[model samples]
Target chain A: MSDAKKFMYINRKAPYGTIYAWESLEVVLIGAAFEQDVSVTFMDDGVYQLTKGQDTTGIGMKNFSPTYSALGDFEVTKIYVEKESLEERGLSLDDLQHLVWEDEDEDYAEKDSIRLVSRAELADVLAGQDVLFNF
Target chain B: MKLTIQVNEGPYQHQSADTAYHFAKAALEKGHEIFRIFFYHDGVNNGTRLTTPPQDDRNIVRRWSELAEAHNIDMVLCVAAAQRRGIVDDGEAERNGKDATNIAPGFRISGLGQLVEGGIESDRLIVFGD
Candidate 1:
């Protein structure tokens, strides 16, 4: 019922094997142009999309992992990585690409863009979204 | 609350259509308005009327048609996806020179804009997919 809606893009699939991950990113980039409150959640196999040191040269595909870093420039700063998902995959914050954004309010201080949340916290975030895109 | 549901996969092959249907039914039972149900990707297959499942199996397409008829819900199938998958209404059939149109009752074929509009117009846009 809020005038300004909150949008959440849920990534449940891993990248490259299917088009879902790539298409989801396309939607997020376009959604950013709307200037609405946008957030993205990485859960399930989706956590693999952010794994750092991705080398797609052997896969014959462009390595789009770096696109996550550009999200902050598009004002899509809220990137939630579910704690359980990372743990299940034996990954930590160090395994993922570090995303940061400049906080102009704090005199242009760079701040981390990723928020590590538990399953319960992620559920609350999911419930709070006005629009959800899952791919 | 106004809700818009998106189904991104075909019936039976994936649980997306079933989940979306159940979610829509539950929302309607709670008196929430479903502004639109946009079917995209393989989800457009749910609108085809030519499906003939086993007699004992539930007819997913028919179930959606009946639900839309009962609630006057707007069921929209993405035109691009439908065309690629060969799911079309009479209008699309004629325009594309197709031999037949298979879109089921209470369903309409539309552009991707309908999905975006659904998001803008509804209070909540819930997506169900694989």
Candidate 2:
């Protein structure tokens, strides 16, 4: 049980524009059952996926943005958003969904899941992962 | 070292499948273990037996089948993705009420968990795609 591998899913594309973002989320949702140490990174155009308001009604695509809110239920507690990526897109933390997860060990307390970090800091996080899946 | 390769694009239009195929071949030639090769997204299109390439050109699907047979490699296509793409085996064809199946040799349909298990079991998991 202690040997759970570190798996990180790096999202670098915009959602709906391509199927990669949605399919990548599907992998994370399925991989969660294995109980590994899982995390996700949002950079480049991928930051658009976590934005607060996404209406795909006219596009005729499934609005899967709400599914991000349930990732914490699957123990995917570490959601990294690169600071530079947000800045480049002219976005701030308020533009993104305030994602959080419930901590069972702490009497079901709510804990913030999205961690905004500098690109340099994320490089260290990338180096620590045992496996990386990019989208 | 043990490795698992994930191919996310179709064999022809994109070079990811070709690159993944060559990488797997090279790994086998170097005395490495291939845990599995999971076909996902448009990658599932590589599993169709109905592919008809030019006679003078290289056969992508056949090459993959030959390599898998020679190395006894486990080639799997994501079931959900395959279903959406209409890459069905005999059982799937019957179950889904399709008249015929199009799955080629060396590939089987499975859940995304196979990829996850491969990533966990293998020494490395390399992805090739956009």
**Tens-digit lDDT string for candidate 1 (A1-135):** 336678788898999997678767866876677666889999999999999999999989988999999998888889999999999999999999999988889998889999999999999999888777777
The DockQ assigned to candidate 1 is 0.28
Q: If you assessed candidate 1 against the hidden native complex, which CAPRI class would it receive?
A: acceptable
Local accuracy by lDDT, each model: 0.89, 0.95
* Model 2 lDDT tens row, B72-107: 999999998999899999889888899998999999
* Model 2 lDDT tens row, A72-126: 9999999999999999999999999999999999999999999999999999999
Q: What is the lDDT of residue B1 in candidate 1?
A: 95
TM-score, prediction 1: 0.72
| Alpha carbon lDDT at A54, candidate 1 | 90
- Give per-residue CA lDDT, model 1, range B3-89, as digits (tens): 999998999999889989999999999999999999987899999999999999999999999999999999999877788789978
* Model 2 spans with C-alpha error above 4 angstroms: none
